[model samples]
Target: MPKDQVLGPDAIAARLADLPGWREADGWIIRTYRTHSWKGTLMVINAVGHLAEAAWHHPDLTASYAWVEVRLTTHSAKGLTEKDFALAKKIEDVVGWQPGLEGGALEGTPSDPRFAYIKHDR
Candidate 1:
């Protein structure tokens, strides 16, 4: 498929199903990654940036101390496209995501100290 080809709802829906937290909004595929600390948030942002650069399909990212909201759309297509969904999946992989899982768990934990702050009572 062409890099910037726009995708319809059926295709989009089918792709989004396996993507878990990502959703369609304002002509973009969006997902907010939650983190345990500011450091964790930056880590996620950096990982996303690296993936986007590697894929050559960048997304708009809004990063705060505790989260990053990623918005993907193919500006050249002026709408949602395969590039957007394609990158979203890769972001999911790099972020250590498990589909259908929520943000309560520490995703990258011991490897990433920022995610190591919490202790379980049990």
Candidate 2:
């Protein structure tokens, strides 16, 4: 759906149910993952790069030696929208994490805590 189609809380909640390890704050959807090392972290970033390119929707990301933080926001919409949720879902799908899996989910807090903010015509 188009980003302009603003979604209410209920709709957003429903969509989020399908995606775990993600949460909404302010006007963005955020997720964080842990990698094995710097190399693994880059792998995740590169993987996400392809997904973002394919979707034409990019996320705000930060990386460390073994951690990556991804935050999604619909710049065109000026607030949360289906696009953000869609991108978040794609991230989860593409870079899947299985509990107890070797690469498992990222642990610890995010290094950066900021969302990509796009100015809108008000």
lDDT (10s digit) by residue, model 2, range 1-122: 66667778888889888877788888778877776567667877998899999999989999888778898888887778888888888888667743333445655233333321111111
Task: Name the lDDT of candidate 1.
Answer: 0.79
Residue 80's lDDT within candidate 2 is 80
- Model 1, residue 73: distance off in Å is 0.3
* Quality of model 2 by C-alpha lDDT: 0.73
lDDT of 1 by residue, 6-105 (tens): 8888988998998888899879999988777787787788899899999888899997777788999999999998888888988887685542245655
TM-score of 1: 0.79
Give candidate 2 misplaced runs (Cα > 4 Å).
Answer: 1-3, 97-122
- Which regions of candidate 1 deviate over 4 angstroms? 97-122
Model 1 RMSD in Å is 5.9
Error of 2 at 119 (Å): 35
